[model samples]
Target: MCILFATRSHPNYELILISNRDEFFERDTHNTCWHTNSSILSPYDMARNQKTSPTNSETFGTWIGINKNGRVANILNLRPADTPPNKSSKGKVSRGMIPFTFLNTDSRKDSFSEWDSFEKFEHQYPCLTTSGDFNFFYGDIKSKSYRIIDTFGQTFKVLDQNDNDSFVLSNNTFNIENTKKWNKTEEGMQKLKELISKTKNESNNNIILMECFKLASICSVPEEIRNKPYHVDPAITYDTIFVPPLGSNDGEDIGLTITKGDFYGTRSQIVILVSKNSKHVTYVEKVLHTSDRDCKTHSAINPKDFHQFEFEIE
Candidate 1:
């Protein structure tokens, strides 16, 4: 299960967002890199199962990204009915491109920034989102404005800057007023609040980043529960933040193909910190597996080696 957590509660930072990207060990992924063409920074998912739209000429799509203009965009795939996401079967759309579009076209004059108004945003973006069921988060740190579009629910939410709260989204609905948060979301929020308290006196950004990594790695499912036939249960998934490969030990060719991609688990972790003044952004990503090769040649690829970068927001 993939999870994303963002906090505006920090005293020194405007936003501290961390995410755990869970996927099959075999999925091809491009490690975090700066896009020289667009001045955007993000990793790319090369799953080309879906038919491409005219706007999606590029073969790769992005689940999360940030631009030099201080726009941040991310997505969560609402936990499909199938265990390993059934990549080859029924998915007609690539959800990552929603965030990719946001990061690329968020210039103020470009109607993308009009996301603050529900009607304007709804009128503009629903066409792009009509094919997929997803949760998209778009934020302009320079404007201190954030908005969430849930294509599944057709709901538009503008995150209140004045709230100064931590928001956590897993595979569940984020209508905080109408729905109860999943255990994972609640626990993430509480842990984030505690992190804010514990690091109140800390000055080193690196330490804070490490703590965020540890915070995202809270994934440990009981053997009894994990060994059982995998169910698409949110409680079972939300039980922990990190997920180890399932059915890998029992079988040798566990995560060999998209058809045999049952070795589902957390593959990468991302932590992004934006300064309170919105002048700088620190982006860090640690890739645990780029392909099945990393699983066997563990020592060759240092999993904890983070692709880290800092950029001044223009």
Candidate 2:
């Protein structure tokens, strides 16, 4: 499972996100743009590759991605539904390609029309759900297009234009309730920071970043769930601080504070400080991971199988 948090304003984009993968895969890539791995055939890839139905197969899936054209796509796994079997299933589409395809094929101006096309395409292919499933949220800032597509459970919801705010989508559930409780933007940010801190560890840089992104993407916590204390065993916390670039051309600096099990791990959190006046990243802290015993095995949990939070960033 993966979570993405980002804020897009005109030409500038800020993103803090994380991706959680199942334990089987032991690789990570930091490519800026989206592309498919021809050698790695996931269920979605297989469907797309074979032009067959997605009944029972492992497929590629993505958390979030932003295209060079300023298009954005986020996907979450969802629960499979009980539909009548049909022989007319069209070729399936891979989830991994959604972000890249959305960004590459259509511009912001044509988002609405493009969404329609995607829906039609998926409906025909009809991916099957094992235990894993997913839903998608897509938007094109230039075109002012936004949509929510559920592949496994429930119907698609079209977000109102007024609903535009910093929104966070998480696994298993959507956190819309938290958005209503915070009276001030700072309060919300603090809450988000706190949430991310709970999931931090020192072992893997990607794992730590993924937890931070999950918190950053949150829009608000529901009142009912807000007061609830952490229940997951061995709760973790990590810190990520962003330092803006020094000069006009630099990117920005980021510092991470790592902690776990009510104790600071031997290795301090990594920090990535960007210099001012640089168009790209200036410096990155050393990568770290949780201890083997504390490190949880990564796995892909279907979007329908998890919860999500949608909030506004001030």
Candidate 3:
């Protein structure tokens, strides 16, 4: 996924994750669904070329997911410009493998500790490797602990639940230290903070929370900033379609995907809401269909794949 919004501390919920997975519309992917591996049922993904592994028939891998332990892990692929490109692309592990490795482990901390040593993991599976350039965010709601593995920043930022409750991460570096990411950081944070403010004075309500996340998922930058007389990537400007929260007929039927005739637009949406004192989480994922901007037949093309998995967090 390219864009991620997460809040660890909420007045009514333990955690909230609103994410958009942006990729080329042509990249084939399986529907996000629950899978059973030794009786553990969680949302899983299968790569386009499902022959990569024997378990591909059951559950392949995922870029982001939550386990039974209230532990959530999501990764964002760093753009080629953000880091030096790999010289030899002969062999490499899929980014989705990390979540599977973490969820299958008995101890979450141990799994992370093992992940900290990237070299050891690379040694085990020569082809299963990451560039150490991706942004890794994981946290345990029950433990009230979270951390961001900032490969671009070259630091492991440990976040206290009380101290830092909300965060927004995109394909670019999100800190002011890097001049390249300053504008995006400013715009994204503003929209996120607005969502936080809207839900601040309310009790635990899943519907309200979903709407808040929708706002984050579809928020865009100002026209003046977007149309600035400069050569820049449009993805940074965040011009995307808006989808209404469930149970509302307020949005357009074809407004599911970011069909803006550009590269790396919003291809899918994954929204997760975990309420405080609740055993399960509400998970919704929708992978939208590609549209033909010229034909105006986009409404006929609904989401190509959609899945909803609501279950206990253990």
Candidate 4:
């Protein structure tokens, strides 16, 4: 239950990632911070863990994160669309570990341009594949190109200068090359392109982030559908950027054990902008809903309410 829009087409910025993290409000999460014993910047999912050691002092995994080296990784989960799968969390891997592994490790000191760079990295940490399907984009942001692994982890592609001006992903979209994607995904991509074109000659970064937040908050999910039972599938339930709170009834047919009145929706919105020089970065996250504060309806968004950070590349 997530949506991301990214652009490498902008002249002033090397890469821009606009993301929405949608999940159940009941899940406990920590705000973004500099990871312990590492240069990675990411938030922790207190509910999921990898049990790396007996003490498990290692920080829990994450959904989106970046390293001081300018490497970034963001993940979106995929569900069994047509059929219900085993709902047991036993022996299952947490998807947050995928990004946690990537962001914590260092890239090749030589160059990430090497073809074997990602392959060796992926093999170095086998957590690349998780319990369920996922779609992820990761690479050194300075490169202005991202490698994507699709839902089934079968298709792999790189977004470069010659490709589309922007790329968008949701729980939908089997592959980046695939023609079919959620209309909401298409809308985000189009809006990103427009934003890039409009800000081509502009120098202000705030303008860029404002537009990114606006794009992240746009939605295609109808009010009627949102008011209904929530599912992870694009066609079944989640097909929008800003997901409003939807109730879950512990649907057994769908393998969801959520009890009555447990709501699922977008919990946070993130925007990361890496300047063309690649040394400067702007990161912002706006918390919308949580287990304590459940915003059933969308309200006016303000940037001042967001958690903001700026970091220089190491």
Highest lDDT scorer: 1
- Highest-TM-score candidate: 4
Candidate 2 lDDT for residue 94: 44
lDDT of 2 by residue, 254-306 (tens): 11111123111111111111111112221111112222222232111111122
lDDT of each residue in 69-169, candidate 1, tens digit only: 88898888664323363332213456766677667764656644566543555555554545355667778887777877675445455546567466888
- Per-residue lDDT of 1-314 in model 4, one digit per residue for the tens? 68778777788988888888877767778878787665988777887666877776645777898999888988776643433455332226766777777676565564555422445545666655444456667777666546766435454555567775467876654453445556567676778788888889976888888888888877676657654555545353445667766665564332222322367767788899988888998998887766624554433273213688899987
- Those runs of model 3 whose alpha carbons end farther than 4 Å from true positions after fitting are 36-59, 80-91, 108-132, 150-153, 174-178, 204-206, 219-264, 290-306
Candidate 3: TM-score? 0.69
CA RMSD (A), model 2: 15.1
lDDT tens digits, residue span 1-314, model 3: 26787775567766778777665343345556544454333444433222345554443556677776666778776543333333222114455565565555554445444444334444433434443246667666565556665443343444455566677776555453554663444555567677767787776556654665465455454445432223334444333433211111222112122123322345577778887774668777766644223122221135556677777765
User: In model 1, how large is the Cα lDDT of residue 191?
Assistant: 85
- What lDDT score belongs to each candidate, Candidate 1 first? 0.69, 0.32, 0.53, 0.68
TM-score-based ranking:
4, 1, 3, 2
User: Model 4 — TM-score against the truth?
Assistant: 0.84
Per-model TM against the reference: 0.82, 0.41, 0.69, 0.84
Clash pairs for candidate 4? none
